[model samples]
Target: MVMVEYMDNVKLGMLDGFLTRNHQKSLKSLFSRNKSPNANDNGDDDPSSAALNSPKSIPQLSPFANSVVSRCSKILQVPTEELQHHFDTQLPESVKELLTYARNFLEFCSYQALHILSSHPDYLNDKEFRSLTFDMMLAWESPSVETKPQDKETTCSNQEVEDEDGWSIFYSSSTNMAVQVDDKKTVGPEAFARIAPVCAAVADIITVHNLYDALTSSSDHRLHFLVYDKYIRSLDKVIKASKNALASSIENLQLTEGEIVLDVDGTVPTQPVLQHIGMSLWPGRLTLTNSALYFESLGVGLYEKAVRYDLATDMKQVIKPELTGPLGARLFDKAIMYKSTSVAEPVYLEFPEFKGNSRRDYWLDICLEILRAHRFIRKNNLKETKKSEVLARAILGIIRYRAVREAFHFFSSHYKTLLAFNLAESLPGGDLILKTLSSRLLLLNSGAAQHDLSGSPHAKWQPKLSPVSLIALTQLGFMLQKDVHLDAEAIIVGDVCVGEINPLEMAVKQSVLDTGRAEAAQATVEQVKVDGIDTNVAIMKELLFPVIELASRVQVLASWDYPCKSTAFLMLSSYFILRGWIRYILPSIFVFVAVVMLQCRHFNKGKPLEPFRITPPHNRNAVEQLLTLQEAITQVEALLRSGNIILLKIRALMFAVLPQATDRIVLLLVFMAAVFACVPLKYITLLVFLEAFTREMPYRKESSDRWLRRIREWWIRIPAAPVQLIKPDDRKKKKSLDDRKKKKS
Candidate 1:
């Protein structure tokens, strides 16, 4: 008997449901119409696809009408015109379907509207109720957006006026627009009158399950478990079938084309064909089908579950609501029925590995394989003219892959939110249960600590993570470490630094120095020159440009996360500038100051100075050291050039790092001018300025001597000569030379 019942469930309704007379007319008109840009906007495109049409014509119209009628019958006790007014003049066919869907959904609420109508004894006898139901039917019947309200007014003639206290209501008036018949009464806006009832009706419908329980007074009259289970199984099968159908259709549509060739050169090729053009056809509808299947899975899953839970069971037999949905049914089974049977678990395949050479890798691999098969088909049949068409197919395949990835990503993000509704319904406590579920999900996502890093012995077993997973984990780490609670610096340092100094950390340090502080500014000139970090500065500068470009890209892809990108750019750029100023410009300025001060002191001490000479014991070595230091300083000076200065300023503007009190605009300007003057001439003028210029110039001879020392220092440092380091052999040779020089002396 059970087998027979199951077999009976496979009964097919004709394609008749799809081939309605109105649909046939619409289809005929669709083909007849030009569909050109200048096509007329008459009723040709639409032929009364209204939910208000004859209930018998549609596959599932009776349930929809019954639901609405049950709700309207109670509300209709109020005058017909007033009830009609609440519908807000004439509703569009789309809105009418929404009303119907809302009404059907109300049945899952436990038939609250039905009980309200049945309990109100006067509701049935009321003539206005009948008239209002008729008016509602008319509201549904008028199919086109082009259908005027004036025609509806004529159809539902309004003559009777009912008065009670200050309220005067007209019954189904010709122009059903809500108008004040009572001079003494105050009415809310017409828009409010129309929308408020729909909201209330929806709310009332949502509350039906509780109302049904109250009305029925039977705990056993809840929902059936098997019905929803069957529906869910069937729906899942339908989705899979749909997917398979689409895949098969796509495979079958492959087109073949013949090879063609063109030679630009005059010399003819010996080959039979110059080029083979291969292609495969793809339907645009496949993309639409994919989208529809995804949404259908979501919707049908919820609906089937609702129907399962709304089933009523007494001692001997199971009774079910006509409109129970999948979600409500699932809720009923888990919460009320509380069955503990071991059901056959539905099969869910594992998520495909997204980083590998296999077919299970990224969807891109699958798409490329499909394209290859398509190319083979075209080549084999010699129908290769459809190259562009094949290209479009490949492009569509890529787009479809992206769409699927995006859908999966969205599902991953909000899977809990959608599933939570069902889970919350199942559990006794709402929010508390949700919290527990959330905690569990977080733990699962965190995964196990003992996941195998080394290759596991089991051949069937895959790695716990892939390249995409690592990338995702890195992104997740970034998000988690962004706040003040986590050490963002440590995380960045650990990840970016694979072997040596962290590029990100080095960039950040450079930025901090660029901002300039007391310690940085006070460092000795030689110390600054020796510790000069041009390599880091250059790395940071180059890194910053990409970061800036990345930030702009981030703005396009996900604008909300853009501040992070901007900060990355600004930090690197600032570091580059800071290293330049402290290492190069500041050192030169210090040298200048030191020379000026020495000149001042010498002049003040005495005028008994011999003419400046760099010849022996009193001179050249100190000058050579100074010159060597100067050369290093000059290299930095050249780097801190005008073009770079302008680049930094422009970068600063583009990044929008507003200049504050500590930004040192004046210092930057001064350094730019100094670098421009001194860097090009090997810092020669800088050496002169340091040597001769002084505030106290009364002793002119001392100033001149200071100038000579500075000039000698500058020349010796940069002269073209071989500076040799002595190895063991060189040291022995140097000692012999020294001994010979001593003997000669």
Candidate 2:
């Protein structure tokens, strides 16, 4: 039994050469038996009688072929009894007819299956193999039929044109029923619809077959060369048929009246005309007419209506010209905004480039001319009856143009600065200064500082100040003294001079004392006067109110000034640093380092490296090494003498300096002012430090583009350092839960 099985395996191994010959014989017998005149004449007989009348020459399969059939049956999961029954009994007439037309298709599928199984015996279990087999079955079940109408005269009138490549072109005069023009001939929309299904089917088949071929070819095992050759031929036929159908449909199209000024293929926004929803732009043929613009769909059967815009009524306004980039131009260009009383929204029409020529500007010019002519005709007709009204309209038009020009000029001059300031005021730092100052005032009023103020009128009060407030006040005082030259001593706080004290601290102290004095005076007035009026509280209000007002005003000004100061400091620092190091000193250092590193190794080793070594030596030992080093040095000297290397080095140095040259010069001047001219660098640095540290405070958390936050994260290494790692089992459970949710969804 084992020996017999080995022999059977050897026979099945040689089945590739025999499969094709066997298939041809089987196909010939199948066709001949079905096409017999007597069998047809009998008509719908019993299967046994039909088999008896059929041709006696039944195609016999070898044992190998039978084994192949059995293997395919097993792979298809067909029952053994059903498989035997299908082979033994004759199929019904209708099935035989379908099989006769699909002979080549069935043969192709069977051969493909055989090829896959021969190479990959486990292909029966492959998902890709199952999908491909299903696709092949669907293709075989639905055959392409010529959808020609069955009128004898119409069929006779049809012209059948054939190309050298075997593409059939059928044109019937009856198909032009949809576009029955008195003076012109054209293909109707129904003609495209009739042939669209066949073209779409061919396209789908080509796509699926190509994908299958690609997937199968990418595997480790190779397909038979003939199989690929046959697939390529099938693909070429379908593609050619699709192209010919599209071309024929377009060629038969004719315009109704106007000569086509421009003809191109593009997409138009779908107009809700019938049952179809207007959701996306549909591909269509765009044609520009002398009096109107028209767009017609390329595909048929879809409930899409042709879009038409009458130049006389619909061209209400011509929008300003915009230059769309390459990608936009491919989509559509020379967009015109159009409106009509009938439609709620304005319709946008675009003229795309046709072939290599873009007639967008030409089309636009013609449209404008049409609009102008129409307007002129209407005005001429009305001029005799309404002369005064026409004159008023002309004056209004002139006034409108002049006003628009002046408004544009005004905006161009002043709008940019105002826009920048408005944007700056919206940032978090703008509100931050106000909040910080308000919170500080509230703290001073509510804390023990209020009690200290109530104790004695002569006692001086000094409230604690936040670092941010202190830095802001110091910078403000420095600016006031230097720029405005205002003496801080003009504003007195308690018994001390303002210039001799911290202004913010003094303001907070005064506000706290004022609140305390007001409260105490109110209590005393309620006890003594009974009129709810206190003289001390009123007096204290006048004296201490200005201090709080000044502090509030300073906070508002600081918000505006803080950003400008920080920007100026950064610009100056960058300038000074680049000029001092990057431009001149850094390049010099890089050159010196390169020269030292490249030269020092040879000096220390007493012999040059391979690329710079000398060919020979006058003596052996130490003298030889010294002489070789001299030769290497001479080579280096010769290389430097060529001037190319020196020029390159010079260029490298200049390349580093050119980009930052202007900025460095400007910053150098600012740096000089800050260092030598007493521009208050310490105050700027202190303010910068305080701002950076408090950048993430509660009030400032709304800031989006936080460079300070990024800097802090980088310094800390891990932004979320306290986060815990998930265990492997927990991660698996989470993934499983997610998958289950996805399945349910």
Candidate 3:
């Protein structure tokens, strides 16, 4: 009878192996020690069920429980919604269990028959029950499986076994226990055979709640801790696995018999700091890469913060043509000479009243002392290298010396009065300066006497006009002056609104102008006065020639030019004054840039004999011509405001024609070629307009001539073109040429 039963059992086992090959391995590892493998099989009908009741050979399942928990914990970190959905369609796990595991709960079985209750179709109808079920799923942990009517203990027979070395009592053989029969399943057929049919019967009770829906529905605190802890732990493992690329070393880091997770040891290094920011698992490939980029961005931002505080401040002091060493001393000497000349003037002659009290007085003394130290260092025959130190000491002396302070007091009082006068006029009356200047110029040009113009016939009538009269009377004279005023006003508004100067016009003009200035300045050598000898004096004269030439141009600008006249001159003067006072306090680079800009402007705009001028038509009244000029100015100004603010039409025209226009490709091509040729930064940014538009340009040809030719062709094709002159004789000449060509052909 035992032999027949054994044969029947073997046949059943083989069939089971075929049915659950995949789940068998896990089941063998999970339920291998269950004494009653057929505990719920209702085997009163099957004779072999009685044979399975022996307990001697059954391995203990308690040890495998931790391993099962650990495995689930690690898997929970993965994007499991898709996987859970797949399992839902393929397997028979309850919806609650699917969601609980999907949510990565640390404990999954705490709520009473949660999966069973959630599986009912009617569960959705009871909002409260559904809500409660969701909360349980989020926070659930394992509990003993619910007791069932079928859980009755069966009286089993005990057996004895004899081996070569020993005799033993066998309650059950290993074969009869939950031993793996195939690689198809995690739990054997014997384990689920009893549960499968029961689960299938409860299909009507199943719900399909996913982790996302569960989490969305519930806000339970207990569930949060379980979900988060497990999720984080799962993430830690996932990150580690990802780093290792799911290699074999993962398996080698195995747990002990009953242990679920590997314990942290002194040997293994801790996880990176970024891992602790959240209570969620490590991200997948795309998310992980994005996270790494964000971390890098944060690191860069932190470094930039330090740069702003420390390095940027220092950078402001460096990168200057001025204040390097020798150049600063020369500027200081010039300033002292200017101060001394000014002190001899009528306004500055009486300096006594200023001696009592003033901050301006204090700063002036500092400047004077610096100048004195600089002179003293030279006069006493100090070492050339030590001159700067002495100058610095002289600066300190001005700050501290009493006699210097009195001189400073006079200078400071005069400076303050001048500054206040200029500020009031420049800031408040600035609105009217250009208008007044234009009106004054227009009046000068219009020769009609005031008394003679009072009741003349033309008083009631507007006069006839021509384009030339329009250009001369309005734009070239009156309207242009008004336009300057309007432009200045617009600039102020723009600066306030945009929080920056609109250097577009200035930048465009400077683009070409800078090249000229740079070349000229470079040609000019540094100058030093020679002692005693006639040859040394000649050398000094030669050395000083370039600077004298540049200074002469500045004098012309200071004497003439609308932008530098009156208020303009006063504004620039005050700028220099303020600059001198704060030279030590502020960075030398700022002052250097300012001075370079001034010198460049003077050379470019204040040169003798300007090549172009706005001439009037042959005949027209000054008033009519002025109105026409005003309209033209208005149109041009509007165009400038709309686009390419840096290049006004007049300036663009000047850039086109002036400055030896023959085959030079223009600033744009020159800039592009330089960039292609990897030019130095100072030269690189010389052409501001070109630099702005083509900043990201890839390298191309370095030949400026080729580049220039192309640019000229492009410029000719552009929409804006200057008006051309036509001659009646040219038409006759062209006809004859055409006739001759036809005869030749």
Candidate 4:
């Protein structure tokens, strides 16, 4: 029955819940009229695909909607009246009746205008195209006068700018023009986040805000056109170069079918890449593909057979930056350590540079992007072209990241990573975004079959033109996927919608919020990181002082140095045990802790927390501190050895190293087990408590000492278990191929 249930879920897919089934057709309807829809979008005879014929009975749009329509007219080279008429005609009656009618109409115009602009070779390069599109998004935010309210800060007037940086965001929106944007005009994070991810191959929604932060980091977080233009163009240059770079080592690397090469290193003599296995080191050529890493060592002035380290398969792989040196001394931090289940040991690739490991860092970032992309693919169990699409997306993202790195020389932070999938894996709510994206990928139809626009099975998705970036790349003469082909006219439009945040964008926003909170908490932690071990120990000791004091008091009573107190404690403890009141001890402790917390909160309401006061250990020099740590470790080792010796003696008795002792101990155990099984638990506990309580009494002290001494003597006489150590098997880790023919003699 369990197996049947498991198989059902497996068939449905682990992410079945994330597949946006029955997705409403609001934005889909608006984005329906691309320059060329996918074959699956609609049949040629479909009425919905035909040119719009305005019906004058439709109601007039609001002021905001009128402005959006007018701008669309300018971009399309059509009259405002005709554009507005076309928009009203395309509006489904069911959609026109909603409160969001004007917003939907605005989205309808914006989508068509953007689609037309997408065909132009320099659309992204055009300042007006960027500004007009940004205004469309702003108009979508405040679609009509009736929907307008507070949060005036969201408008263009209060653009995100810092005066201290001698720069401001864009000016207020014009009543005539969409947005009065120019060289001085600025944009906020939200605006950039919305616009950039549309070029999904360049910016991912999960990391779009981070990418914005990266671009505007030096500009006081105010996104100026200069920075935005530079970044986009740089990324553009990177994509163009990277697409052609795949051919550099196609035959030499021998990449498998469908594998796209990401990056390669170690071609230059002055900047040779060193491969280290154990204590041996040699210069090599390293290549990274979407699936694996290949390193070919230089032998006799030529590269040898490449050793492949698989990344596409799950192998609990660990890749990180580490230091390496001659003879394994680890004196330089210019290497990457790659370890996986497929390899017997970790392999280190060192990028030798004169000063820093910038070269190494680049290799690390690109390699990790490919590694993480595959992990995401394997985690979701994606298949075929969908899998190819994911790898292609990752490949493009890395190239763009490299472009920015090369142009700006800026390294992204943990919260501001440039890689999309890498950011998703690191961000808090990113799984939901990935789930939505993965489901959306499966929605793209790659067949010759056609259906009516309204009746198409995937009509709910609206746009089927993605892997848009790859399509863009292919158009520019670079080919990554031979098995998968997308519509030639596919243009990347992200998941942004008409006056509504899509689920994927919502997840991204939430994750970015969480990331900000995480960075804040980490900042607080950084502020409190004490350097000295003695200071840390002092803090811990202060925190646990009450528990330490209680244990000391219990020890004093058990010593019986004060007979009256010891007797009273013993009787009280026994009485509590007999009444079974000790069962409530843990609950009582919890209640006490809660009360203490409340009391502290009440008293500290208007005050900051009092500083923790501790008389730290005497100040010591660095050498003295090191000596203290070593001494502590030595004491712990001593305690472990003593414990092991005691266990070994018990092992000897169990194995009958001494027949008399074994028989005695075995009978003693049988008697204890029988007592536990047959006797009432309360009576047994009372008997044990009484025996220990009276052992330190004045009358029995002498005999107790004598008995303890005898017990010690007996323990010392017991033989310990013998131990043997065996050497590990030594085999050659890697062997060269042996030819079948014998050497000529």
C-alpha RMSD for every candidate: 33.2, 44.5, 43.1, 10.0
lDDT tens per residue, model 3, 1-745: 2332232222222222112212212212222334354443354353233332322211111222223322232222111222223334432233235333322222221111222222232332232332232223222222122211111111111222435533221212222221211111122212211111111111100111111112112222122222212222232333233334323222433311211111111111231111111122121111111001011111322211110011101111111111111212221111111112212221110111223323323323333333333334344454422332232222212212222222122232211111111111223232232233222222221211111134332232221111111121221111211222211001000000001111222232233244446545545533222232334545556667877897876555444343325336445545554455433536776788799999888888956654322222345466766786787789988987755533443354555653443234466577787786896443433344243323323332245446778876765544433445769899899899999999999
Candidate 3 segments exceeding 4 Å error: 1-119, 131-745
Pick the TM-score winner. Answer: 4
**TM agreement with the true structure for every prediction:** 0.15, 0.17, 0.15, 0.76
Model 1 bad stretches (over 4 Å): 1-716, 719-745
- State in Å the error of residue 370, model 4: 2.2
Which window of 10 residues has the lowest lDDT sum in candidate 4? 11-20
Q: Which candidate model has the greater lDDT, 2 or 3?
A: 2
Off by over 4 Å in 4: 1-79, 82-111, 116-184, 313-318, 321-323, 331-333, 341-344, 353-362, 447-473, 483-494, 598-608, 691-695, 725-745
Q: Model 1, range 1-745, lDDT digits (tens) per residue?
A: 2322221111111111111122212212321213332222463432222212211222232433333433332232222222233332322233235434332222211122222222222232333333333333332333223332213332213343446631123212212212311211111222111211221111111112222222112213321111111222232233234335444433333211211110011111221101101121111111122101010111222211110110011112111112111322221111101111221221111111224212212322322223342433343332222222222222223322333223222121111112222222322343343343222222221221112234232212211211111112122121111121211111110111111222222332343234245334546443423222443344455547766786667444332234455456445544544444425767787898899999888886876545322222222355675786798889888888744655654555445454441255456678878988767443444444333332123345466667778866743433232235679988999899999999999
Q: How far off is residue 473 in model 2, in Å?
A: 82
lDDT of 2 by residue, 1-745 (tens): 2332232222222222223222222211321223432433347544433433331221232222232333333332232234334423322232234334232323222332333231232222333333233323222322223222111121112243445753222212222321222211111222111111111111111112222223223222222212222233333333233234334333334433212232233534452211111233445555443345556655674424456666544335443334342333434445555455645565554444444213444334334444443343353443221222222222222222222222221111111111111111222232332233334333221111122224342333343211221111122121101122112111111111101222323343344345456656667767544211233344455557767797775454344446655456545655655444334657887898899998887686876444322223222466665776688789888987655544543454445433454355468678877765664555555556456534544456457237657755543432221225899999999999999999999
Best by lDDT: 4
| Ranking of predictions according to lDDT | 4, 2, 1, 3
**Model 4's TM-score against the true structure:** 0.76
Note the clash tally of each candidate.
32, 0, 35, 2
- Residue 28 C-alpha lDDT in model 3: 21
Candidates 1 and 2 compared by TM-score, better number: 2
